[model samples]
Every structure is written in structure tokens, then in C-alpha cells.
Target: MAPMGIRLSPLGVAVFCLLGVGVFYHLYAGVISSRIATFRQKKTVDLRELLALSIEASVQGGREVKRIREDDSLQEKTKGKTKEGASEKLTLGDLNSHRKMFYLFKNTYPFLQVNSEEHDSSDGEATIWTPNIPVDVLNKVPASQMVPSESVTVWIDPLDATQEYTENLPKYVTTMVCVAVDGEPVIGVIHKPFTGHTAWGFVGQGANVAPRESYNANNPKVIVSRSHSGKVKAFVQQAFGNSTEIIPAGGAGYKVLALLDPSDDEKPDVYIHVTYIKKWDICAGNAILKALGGHMTTLKGEEIDYSGSEGNPGGLLASVGMDHKKLVSRLPPWDQNK
Candidate 1:
């Protein structure tokens, strides 16, 4: 006998080999997916961590502003200068001592990137910025690198309404974070450190309207920047004139939220504004607003595109209610006096 020749079924051998390959491929895919998921989780954690750090930096800015307001020595340097001319005297270089804290906290993060609207960002980016507004961390963030599932652009006016901050307005200054996706806000967080109060809105995610003390529904309120004035007040007066009460608050982020929520007992139906600002000013906050089932657009009801050049500035008209069309019709465009 020839050592009893052994026979194996070709089909069975082939099936076993295929099964082995399938198992290996499945494991390889699982590992890859797992790694991707882990990366996303870590990124999210990092963003939140960054948010906390930003809050710290914002607080520092607030303190600096307060000192400017309280310091007779510093105020004397800027005494002759009007609030409009305050920036001439105020320089980031002068705040080097104060800004060091921001630098220190900023360096701790490995993936930190400048928000395009940073004062030092390219001229095109900064051109859109309104005077006296501090670009928050999100303003410098590159659009290409945001979280994948939900694209976001954040506006961090670390010291929003800076003029007020420098003018001795207690708690008039604030730190803001507006989260927007493709031009709509999905979530937003605004903190008034002076009051130790926080307000958050997550579209469809249920808003907490934090700062328990800040939550009220009796008298609706609207916040506005301390320095810039005109169309916002006119629109409010014409829209709500006798029907609703208008409470003017300072800070764009704060104002936007005021319409979403009011510290008074009643909430306003709409928040409207017409001004020249860049994508960095409202992108993040708009994301949060959109998430809350609201909409923001130009007075013409056209969507504001972030891709435009700085010269083509876009203004906003946001509404928690869909009453923007009526309001738009009633008010004149920024260029035209209605």
C-alpha cells in the first residue's frame, strides 16, 4: 500500500480557508473602526477641555478690562479718548502681562489652532471684525478641522462688548461660545462670570436656561452691544413698539441669547440685528441657535455664507419664532433707511 493515500475534499478546504480570511478581515476592520471612534471621543473631550480653558482666559480678559476701568493710571492714558477711540490706546502688546495667562493655558493643548478672526489673523479675516470685540478661541478655528458629524464654527468674544468692559459697566462684559453648523446654531453657551451665571441652549436637546437666577419668563429682554447702535434699536422699536417691552443688554452673544431666553419673566419672540460683522462673529452662536430649532439669516431672508470675502460683510436677523419675514419687511436694509 502507498501509505494509504489521504484525500481531502477540495470544497471543504476552500470553505475553511475562506472562513479564516473572513475572521481576519473582520478583526482588522473592527480595530480600525475602534481607533476612529477613540479618536473622535478624545477630540470631543479635548474641545470641552478647551472650552474650560477659554472660559479661564475670558475671565482673565474680563479682569484686565475691570482693571482698566478701575485703574486711574490706565484710565488717565485713555481719558481723552472716547470709547470709539479706546482701541487706539488699547493694544494687545500692552496687555502682554495679562495675555500671558491666555498663552500659558493655550499652550497646554497640543491641537490648538487659531480661530481665523484672531486680531493677528490675516487682514481678510480680521476685516470682518467689528471694533472693540475680542475674538474668542472659536473665531480663529479653521473650518476644515471641526468635528465631522456636526460641522461647527464657534464665536468666542472672550470679552464681548469690550467697550462696556473698559467703561466700568459691571457684569456688562461677558464670554460667549456660539456653535453653528453650515450656518445654523445647534448649541450655544454664554457665561457671565461676574455673576457666576451660565446660559445654554441645545436645539431639540432641551435648553437648561442656566444661572437659575437669570431664568425668568415675565419680562422679555434683548441684549445689544454697548457701543454699536442704530438698526437694532430701530427694529426693536418698530417691531415691538407698543406690543412688547424691550430691555437692552450688552454683548452680541448675550443679546442673541436674550431673545432665546430672558432673565425677566417673559421671553421675547424674536431677536433681530443689522450690522456688518464677519463669519467669526456669529458662526458658532448661530450653530447653537439652529440646533434649538431656530433660524438666522440676512434681513432679506437669504442664508449668510461664510465663504465670502471680508468686503462682502453679512448681517444677521435671527428668530426663535418664524416671524423674521414680517420683521424684515418692516425694517430697512442696513444700506437703506426705511
Candidate 2:
């Protein structure tokens, strides 16, 4: 027993050393798993060809989105035909019209994934593209069946600016492809196909025009809806106070890009998804924002968790400036029913 109290024997010493190594390996394994988990959670989407096709179709089909937008009665008739009896709201119009266009474009442009179910209400629509995992299919697949833990995962907001598109505002509307590495965005491509212009951004990797600067500077620009409601306007006013400059952009994607390294020097410093900001509304933009060393958190400063739900909480708040604490602080509380 080697005096029982003091184990000086070689066997005892070896056992203790082995235990230490085991503990170290356990911790090391945990770290590796964390990195792996982060990587797997990263998300992205590719809309280059699809966007071009959409625009091309829009060139012929653009008249349709615009036609319905201008003729309220046409919209009402289209929605009334739906099983859900959608209202005249822009989002509903978008779903019904796009659903129609999908059928129209299917024979000619079969690549746009028109067969997927329409997951829109009076709020918005969520469609699936087959090339990338259909959201519905992704929901069914277990995490284990997904790519390796070190691989990246992305969610495509195929038609991000549905409202803008429905409103005949392709300038504000855009298509995006964003990729994230280890839960942080690294690559982003936002294309305003109508104008044949695109803005790209990167993190730890910089873009052509985006500077490593605060998100908000003088003349702080804001992208707002062309058809804003009084309630939303009042809320925005309260949040930013008077003398705030707002630049109207057609789509949420345009708004997000406007906040940071905007294609137009007149882009805004902040992007606010005040009401009904669905997951599709912010997914691609979130990928880009995070890529530029920026963040899109809830008003209370909590990191938003995507890949878990298609419905996002209320609206989102984001900025390229780290000093955007005021936004949350001055937030005008809202209701979910809206």
C-alpha cells in the first residue's frame, strides 16, 4: 500500500496522468464540437440566375405585378378566387398573383419552383426552390441528415420583397445570395436586376465600396415604405424623433443594403422592419448584415435565432454602427397582432 496515504508507485502515477489527459481531451472535444455547431448553423442562398430569370420574366411578367398593383379590383378578384379568400392587402395580392405567375411561367420557366405550396396569408408568402433544400423538406430532415457539422447551411428568401414587387417597385426590390461561416455572414450579393446593378459585401473580407466605419453618420438615411401607414410613421417618428431623414426604398433587401455600403450614396444609416417582418423579410439581409460586422437583433438586444422557425418575432432592428444602442432604447413597443 506504499504507506497507504502516499501513492508514489509508478502504476498510481500513470493512472493520474491518464486521467488528466482524459479531461483535457474531453474539453478539447467540446471546443471542436462548438466550432462545428457554429459552422453548421451558418446559412446562405443563391439567387443569381433565378433573379435574372425573375427579372426577365418580370420584363414580360413585370406588367402583371404592376397591373395588379394599380388595379385594386383586379387584385380583389384574384384574391377572392383563392381558397383562403385573401384580402386586398399587398402581401395577399403578391401570393395570389405570384401563384398565378408560377403556373404561367412553369411551362416556359420550369426552374422557378412553382409547384411548392403557398404558405402566405394576409401577411406574406413563403415559397420553396428545389435546387436548394425546400424549406418544407429541410423541416422534415433531421439535423443528423444535414451536411457535416463543419459545413455551412443557408435559407433562401427567394422573393424577399414581395410587397415591393407587388407594388411595381423593382428598384426597391432585389434578389440576394448570402453565405455565412460559423454563424457569421461572410459573403453577400444583392442584385437590383431591374437596374442591372448589384452591391456585394464581405466581412473579415471587405467589399469594393463598404468601409469599416460606424453604421450611422451625418444625414443618417432611413429606408421606409412608399405606402406607409400612419401608425408605422408615428412609430418611426417616435423612434428616431424629429429631423430624422428617411429615404424611401421599395424593398427590405434594398433597405438593408442602404444602411451600410449602399449602391446609392443616398442610402440610409438604419433599416427598420417595423411591422410584419417575416423570416423571409430578413434572412438574406441578416446574412449580409452579419457579414459586414453588423448585427440584426431584437429591440431588447437579443441575438435572433433563425433555422428554427419561419415566423420571426414582430419586426427587426439592425445597424452597421456598433453604437446603435439608442435604437433599442428608444423603441416604441408594439403588438404581435399587427
Candidate 3:
């Protein structure tokens, strides 16, 4: 006659509620983690494709030039425009690639609220940048330096080693990105599309090349730009002496990787470039090398300020597993006038 009812004791009810909450939390955490991983994987794929597209464009431009040279009629018709066309094609390809990557990052991480200020670009194109993720969110940077993520700047090198790419040295070309918080590199990503190899790192989190390989302390090998070795040659001789081997490499990013993963017969220990360089050219490599127990600074032993102008007039000196202070001490004082 009484209404059918089932009532559990307080203890039983509490146990049931606790179990439900635990299960829900587990599922939620799994989904969040999965989403983050998927986003990163997608970003890597997009970057690889961008690099491939840029390389293809460059190769095609070269072929077009060759065809023009081979055919007299074609050469005559394109006389004034041959050089211009090739340069424009490469430049346009790089610009388009940059735009694509910018959009991808913007769309994928909408929460970051990326925006481009007018001052960010001189060519009138939008300069894309996102509000920095908090230091705790990154969890890889020192809290003192990175807590105010608003000061962080994102540096992207759509295609590094432009000269190498034009010369058909695809292996040296790479797409690189770095996040610098308060003028210190906190994260970096470098992707070599030709080889389909990607390396990434964060400040305190170390790098993909954890437990970096050992190197010879006495004979420290140095890497310099293959195309611009003349200027560095004298400095290499002065700092490392005539005996220190100088390895000719194509891109800064590639050279940094070599410093981390040297050949069986050779062990690269330093990368020195004493000339005007752009922020994008070195940011990614700097971050990775720093994370891997190295240091990158100016010839005067000053750390780079990423937030300043794009041009790095101070020159760069990077060393792997070697005392950067000791290395700087070996070089003569830099003359700004020179």
C-alpha cells in the first residue's frame, strides 16, 4: 500500500557521489589532453606543408630560369624580368606561407586572441601575434621572468636559409618559431620539411634532445654559414685558433641542430655569426640550444632582446656544452664602428 521507495544511508550516498565525480573528472582530463595533443600535431603538419609549398615554388622558379636560358627566344622575351620574376616568386611564396601559418595558429588557438597592430608591419600586411599564454600555463619558464606573459613575443621564420633554398640546398632550409617572454626564449620549434624531422623545446622542460650527446672539450668544432664564411673565418681563427675545425653549414637553425647532433666523426661545439641578422633567423635555434644546456649571446657577451627591432646588430655567438663566458673571454672586444 505504501509508495515504493528506496533510500540509501549517508555513507552509501557519499560513496556513489564521489565515484561519479571521479569518473567525470577523469574523462574531462583525458579529453582536454587529447585535444591539446591533436592541436600540436596538426600545427606540425601544417608547418611541414607550408615549407614544402615554399620549396616547390622556389624549385619551379629555378626551372623556369633554366628554361629561359636554354631557349634564345624565351631568354630575349624575359630579359629584364628573369631576375625580378625569380625573386618575386620566392618572396611571394614565403609571404603566402607566412599568411597560412598565421591563420592556422589564429584559428586553432582562438582563445589566445591573436591580433595584428598597424605598427607590426611596414608593408601594410598585418603582423600577427597572440597574447602570451601564462607562465604557469607554459610551466617550462622561470616564474620570475615569464609570469607576465603579456611581454612575450612570438617570432616566426617561415623559411630560413633563403640562399640555400634558392641554390637547391633543401636539406638546410627549415621553418622555425620561438616564444620569448620578457626577452628570454621560453619555447622553440624547428621543422626540416625535406627530412621530415622536427625538434622542439621549452626552457625548464629541456628539449627533444634530452640527455644531449657529449662533445670534445679540447677541440671544439665551429659551424659557420656556407655562403657567408669569409667574415666569420677571421673570428673563428682568432677565438678557436687555427686548429679548431670550422664546419660550413647553410642555415642557423640547421647549424644549431648539428651542434646538438653531431656526426660520428665530428663534434660541433660552437656557432658564431658576426653580422646583421633578423630576429626570426635565430630565435628558434636560440631557444632550443638554450634548453639543451647551451648559451647564445652577442660578441660582447650580451643576451639578445627579442622585443626590440627585428635587426640583431649585436651579432651572435652560440656554444654547446661549453662555458659561454669563457668562450666570450677568448674573443676580442667588438668594435661597433666596424
Candidate 4:
């Protein structure tokens, strides 16, 4: 009303300001969410590229080392004594040229801030860009139920099949795993260096390949680790009987992939491992298999808890399109304490 121009009361102006703030917040949140999704997708692709490059470099020729004992620094860091306090070892296999390739990839990305301590070779300048999105915001899981970031884990097996990789069997080698939140694997990425195939998924979000196979089977085709076959062979024989077709495979992730996408010659129905297997070996594969209507658990039928030390003391069993309880019943007695 002043000078015949539009005028607003103080309350009206306040209301307008609030509306403006609300719009900005909505827009900002959308942008952040988009960025996070893009970042994840990019990381998966980049990881596959790095693995491929490493494989090629190794083929060109490099010295191979084996059974190298962990130095004090590596042992202490792996034992959860460091500030990172993550109870998982970076690499389990012997230090070799392929493993060196892993270090090259890890140093190149450094997106995993948790591995900052291990990045001492990176000029002590690891860029830290930890995502702060609340769990409830990312998924349907409620924030109150979400585990703290410190407790939220990221399990990684940079080169899953070391024996296969060193032997020039690139088909069996893979760059495996990433991101488990609150002991539940939330994000997983598995890359086959030889095939240039990558499969990734997040919990609740269906995988690239949806579940379609039926679990009903008389004699299931089983996959056992080629390197660690003794215990698994016995367990498979006992659980599924000798009639079950046993196929020895290399990488844990590769075995899961075989179950996910079976070839004409080798159609895997179950993956059973009864010996000491690390968390990194299974987390990525577990996440993908779960997405494909499959289940992975301890032989005792308990869900594998990812919070503890790297070693899976109870052994691991994975089945595609089958009742977990029924599979558990078939197994011999399991003593987790052992």
C-alpha cells in the first residue's frame, strides 16, 4: 500500500522465506542422491577397468612371489589394532605380481577412506570423502535400526583367486567386493578380469539379473573351491551324497557367479565351503546371490554375521533357489565354537 506498490506483511515475508528454503532443501537432496548413485556406478566400472589393466600388465610379465609372511605393520593392521579397527586383512594370498596390481588400483582410486592407513605409499595424502547419507535416507531401513558408520563395514578381496591369477588362469580370477553396512552387505561388485564381466547389486534393489530359476532339484550341481577343496569335498559328499555333481572352482565370487549365470556345460546349484574362509571372500558374492533369490549362511543355518573378525569360523554354505533350512538339515552336525 505504500507508494501504490505491492507490499507484504512481516508474517507473509517470513512464510515466503520458509517456502524458498524448503524448495532449496528438496533440490539439494535430490542432487546429492543422484551424485551418490552415479558415484557408486562409476566406482564399479572403474574397478573392473583397473582389474583388466592389472591382468594385462601381469600377462606382459612380472616377477611372482608366494607365501610371503605378513610383516609387523601388515599383521598389526589386519588384527584390528589400528585406528581403522576394521578386523579384515587386505590380502590373504601370497604377495605376488597380481597383488601388486591390486595395490596399484587401490592407490589410484583411494575412494575407500577406511583403507587410508594402508595407503601410506600414497604420499600420506589420502583424500577423504566419506558419504554421510543416513541409512534411512538411502534405503527403506530405518535410521534407528541402522548400525553406526564405525560399525558399518566394507569387505574387499581385491584379487579373489590369487592361485588362479598367478597360474595365468585369468578366467578364474576376479576383482571382488565392496561396502557392507552394519554387518549386512548393502553394496557388492564383482568383476571378472578375463571376461570383462561385472555384476553388482545393493540390498533390496534387485540385481542386474532377476531371480528366475527354480530350487526344486533331485541331484544338485555343487561348486567347491579348487584351492581349498579338502573340507568342502567331504561336506558336499556328506550333505548331497556322492550323486551330487561336484565342480571344483577358483574364486569365491566366481563360484557364486557360476551359480548366478551357469554355462551350458557347468550349471552350479550350490556352493559349499566348510573351512576357514574370510569375509571378503564371500561378502560381495553373498550380496549378489541374495539379490538373485539365493541364500548364504553358516552351515549351522545362522546368518553369517559380518561384524566379527575376518575369519568365518563356522564355515559357509550358499544355495540358489533352495530352502535354506532343508539344506542345513542335510549337512552333518555343526559346532560353531570349533
Candidate 5:
């Protein structure tokens, strides 16, 4: 064996090593490409699954909101008030519900990016949320392509209508979840704890509920914030005529629901808010609107981008059955309203 051995020059050795490296790279790349092709099929959730998960999470959060309120354990307090006498309150319900949902999504996907309204979710709550995805909700979700985990941002408003919640108005309280994909709201789940009614919507997929048929879009019944009507009342009244019927309401979730309500007398034609509002306050509503062939945008009629800042500045107008552009065109500049 020693007598049969042969030696190679330095250049030959270098070429041989280079060839070996090229072969190894080709093999590794083939395996990786094969895995990449089957990744979603073998080991990932579809958009529908995430949508159902969101609905379940919202329902659980809503349950906590109602249970905490009924037990008289909410223990509400004024967190702070803006210079405009607009007070923001916080309750134990808010903290617990958010903690419940934050863990709910985190534990399930472990990769979702969640933007919550509550900033005090440092402590862990006794994880009471079950991973039960509602069968009805899952069945209703339309099948869709899977997105990369990092492209989705889940926005949570654990307790909407805090003031109304403190004031014993259960109808106005809601827990909301919005899943925005690549800066666009694609799934929305808004649950009213007091009513046990859940509304879920996906951008391309229609909602479970439908808008009423009897609505007169020309007359346009508008729903606005009860506490922060501010100059919005005058602005809406002027744009839609004096008889347009401006209904004061609480919570972005409630206002959006009012638009989708089937009741003839109660359902409003539009939801308009003329003030700087947080993204979590309206993201779910906006998705719900989009799902129903409706749309929500700045008072200036610009579509909102949810990937970046948390606050939406130029006010908002959400409408179904009416021309959003035409409606917004009628309104004056947002700055001039005040």
C-alpha cells in the first residue's frame, strides 16, 4: 500500500479541495431548497388558523373583561387626562385581559408580533386561557395562503370603552384583536363580553355578519365618540346635512359594531371620529369594515398604515354602503374643524 501511494502538487490539492467544496454546497443547497418548498405544508399554519386563533383569543379576553367587571374586581382608576379634559382610565380588567391574550398568542405561535394598548403587562397572570379554537370560527374562516411569521402584527385592545366600562355600560365594552399583515389589516376579531357576541372578519374573506339592507346611505346616520365629540359633531353635521342624525357612542369597537348592526333603527350608516386615536382603538374596526366591502380612512380619505406608529393623527371616517371618498370630500380640512 505504501509503494502504490502517489503524491499531488500544491495546485492539484487546491483544485481538489475547491471541487469538494462545490459538491458539498450543491448538496446542501438542494436539501435546503427542498425543505423550503415543503415548509408551509409540513410545519406551519395557514392564515385561516391564525384568524380563528385571534377570534378565540378575543373571546377569552372579552370573557375576562366581563367577569372582572361583574365581580367588582376591576378596581378602575384614572390613568391620566389629556389637556382637552379627555381622561384615560385603567382597570384591573384591562391589565389581566391583555396579559391573558399576550400569553395566549405568544404561547401558541411564539413568533407573533403583538402591539397591545396596555403597557403594564410585566407581571404574569394565572394563565386561564385555553387553546381552544372555536370550531364555528375556524369553519367560517376562508382558506388562504400562509404568510411568513414575521410579516404579521397582532394589535390588541384588551379593554375598549374603559370610561363606559366604569360607568356600568356593558354594551359599550369590547375586547378587540387585529392581525395586520405587511402593514395591512387582514384579520379582525371584536368581541362584546356583555353580549357574548363575537364578530370576526378577514380582509379578503367576508364577515359572518352583514350590514342591514334598509339603511339609507344618502341620509347617512353617523356615529361619533360620546366623550370626545369635540368639533367632530359640527364637522359631521355640516358635511352630511343637519338631519344626518349624529349618534354619540363609546368605544371604537362599539361604533364599528353599530355600523354593522342588522337592526333597522340602531345601525348607523357611518362611524366617524375626529381626534387623534390610538391604532389599537381602530385597527380591528378598520379590518372589519374592509372585510364587509366597506373602508376606514383618515378624514382626508387616506388609507391608514398600521406597521409603524401607534397613533393615527388626522381623525378617521369609516363607512359602509356609501362612497368613502365622496363623504370625505364633503368634510373640511381636519385642522380647520377645530
Candidate 6:
């Protein structure tokens, strides 16, 4: 397992995340063009440039997502329902957003592997375009602390909370990107499209977030998904006592952000997922949480590995200002089939 207490640096996040995509039909359309291979002087490139591409892609793609919703062109399709009967869905938001991030990287590196939830990855066109390197980020996280390009995996979730979005709950929607090095997420950016708010962090560097204030370990307030609340609710009530407060919300990104919400009534001390979840759904939040000196792991307290594939079957438990293992040990082993 990776070490605990990894930090998130705001400067590090700005350098890497601020990720982008589609506003110009083609990959390099919107911004002034710059070649991304600044360090390919015989085969070595800086991690900062790749992160810049992600940031620009995420920013532009976020605008497209908000525009799609504003135009009422969701093109929604039923993906069945969650176990508790909430709708499972897909929309143009998911497809287009995935493509935006993919094109930004594939067009430049051509061979770089990016993990996503959508299936329309055909590599239709390749264009060489990327944002200029973020110098401010380099000044924060020097080269010595970063991993090589070959060891990185970028996980992008174009639109999270599709179900909430369809239900006219735009407040919960977000676009996210995570860069994991050697199976540990080193950087992440979570962009809320409707509000144009983006929060990002690079592990061990520090975060733009503040310490939590609403946690009462003896009677913690926890957040879980509206659709997947039964098991998680039971676990929290059991582990933290029946008096523990449980807040049901949508979107993994939203839940993770809530852990740092400044409002007393809105902030949740913990976020938990009771079943198998896709890597794209939780990877960015994990990276951000880790960067904040927090923990996000399975019920057994093992860290989630973000090296490819979509599913994590061990379940999840995340907290920002508390002992993650102490919380984990309080719960009895949960049945996966329950």
C-alpha cells in the first residue's frame, strides 16, 4: 500500500490540473497552439506539460458540459436503475467530455493511455496541441518528487452525477481528472461545471483547502449516495453509533468536496461507497483527499489502485480530518453480496 498522509499542493494542482478539451471541433481549436513535446529532445518530457493539457481540456470541456445542459440536449439514455431504484443514465455530457480529454492527449502523444468511463474511444483524429507549461507549478513540486511519464495513468470523468443532472440537480455535477503515478494518485482536479469552481491538488505538495470543523468522531456526520445508501447507512450507524448523522447526496466529486465544505450544516466528516465503483468515479477525489493529508480506502483500509480497469470491488471509506483506520476498524466486515 502507498504511504499515508500524502499532501496536496495548490500550486502543484494549478500546474497539472487546470486540464482542458473541445471548444473548436478539433483537439487544438480553442487556444493558441503550442507543441507539447518541449522536452522530447531524444525522448524525455516534463510532467508539467502533460498536466497543462489536462487542465485546459477540463476547463474547456466543463464549459461544453454546462452548455449542453443549458441547450437541453442531454440525449439521455436509460442505463437501468441503481439497486434502490434511482435512475442510472448516460448523456451527451459523458460522451463529449470523454472525447475532449482523450483528444487532447491522444492527438499529442498518440500512444498515451487515458482511462475513461465512456466507450466511444476510436482515436478518430490526431492533432498536436497543448497548453504552455505552468511555471508556477514547477516552482512548487520540483522534478525530484514527480514520477516519469511512463508510470502515469490519467483517469478522467467527463461528467459525474448524470442521474442528479437529469433530475435537475446541477449543483452536484462536476468534471474530474486524476493523474496516478505507480498506482497512487499524485494529482487531481474536480471542476463543477454549473458553478465554474475547480479544486485541485498534488499529493505531498499541499492543497488550497482548509482543515475540517464539523467532525465529531463520537457522532460523525457521514455522506453516502442517494441510490446506494442502504448498506452504507447501516455501516455508519453501526460503527459510529445510531446517533451518527448520514447525509444522502449525489456524485462522488460532490461528496468529496463536501468533506471540506465551510458551512457547518453542509459539511460531512466522511464519505463512503458500499459497493464496487469505477475508478473514473472516485480516482480524482482519492487523489485530492490524499493530497489533503486524508485517506480514501476500502473497508479493510487498503488503498485503491488506479492502474487501469474500471472496477474497485473492495468498497470505500474516505475522511479528511480523522483517523481513517480507526474508523475502518470500528466496522465489521461487510458482505459484498448484501
Candidate with top lDDT is 5
Better of 1 and 4 by lDDT: 4
Q: Residue 162's C-alpha lDDT in candidate 5?
A: 92
Encode model 2's per-residue lDDT on 1-338: one tens digit a residue: 55656646898899999999999988798898878865654243233323333333323323444444456533422323211233323344345544543543344333222322133434322332333322322342223222232333233333445555655666675544444334444445565545655555444434433534555544355567554434456666777776777666666677777776534677567766555544445655665676566778765666665444545566667787655666677777776455
Compared with the true structure, what per-residue lDDT tens digits does model 6 show for residues 1-338? 97798576998666555453333336564333334344442243445565566666777668878888999999999767655465679998877777777677667765456887766846543545645745655665556443466777888888889989888799889888888887888778888889887777778875556557647666678899888787677788888888888899999999999888786466788888888788888988898899888889988899889995778888889998888888998877787666
All candidates' lDDT scores?
0.49, 0.51, 0.62, 0.59, 0.82, 0.77
Candidate with more favorable, higher TM-score: 4 or 6: 6
Prediction 2 global C-alpha lDDT: 0.51
lDDT of 5 by residue, 1-338 (tens): 55776789999999999999999988798888777765633243467777777787788888889899999997888889753567789999998888888778776765568899887737565454354556665566534558877778889999999999988899899999999988899888899999899998888766777766755667788889998675677888788787778888899999998987876366788888888888999999999889888889998888899889998887899987777788888887678235
lDDT of 1 by residue, 22-107 (tens): 99988798898877765754343233334444445545555554555455334322314432343423433224323433343334
Worst 10 residues of 1 by lDDT: 122-131
Question: Residue 210 in model 4: shift from native, Å?
Answer: 3.4
Task: Point out the worst 10-residue segment of candidate 6 by lDDT.
Answer: 33-42
The candidate with the higher lDDT, 5 or 6, is: 5
What is the overall TM-score of model 2 with all chains considered together? 0.53
- State the weakest 10-residue window (summed lDDT) of model 4: 67-76
Clashes per prediction?
34, 7, 0, 0, 0, 19
Where model 4 places Cα greater than 4 Å from the true spot, the runs are: 1-148, 335-338
Q: Rank all candidate structures by their lDDT, best first, as comma-separated numbers.
A: 5, 6, 3, 4, 2, 1
Q: Between candidates 1 and 3, which one is better according to lDDT?
A: 3
CA error at residue 283 for candidate 1, angstroms: 3.6
TM for candidate 3 is: 0.63
Clash pairs, model 5 backbone: none
The C-alpha RMSD in Å for every predicted model, in order, reads: 13.8, 16.7, 14.9, 13.5, 7.8, 17.3
Better of 3 and 4 by TM-score: 3
Which residue pairs collide, candidate 4?
none
The residue-by-residue lDDT of candidate 4 on 197-311, one tens digit each, is 6676656654555443554356788888875576567777887788778899888878888877745368777788776777878887888777666789988877877766776
| lDDT comparing candidate 1 with the true structure | 0.49
Which one is best on TM-score?
Answer: 5
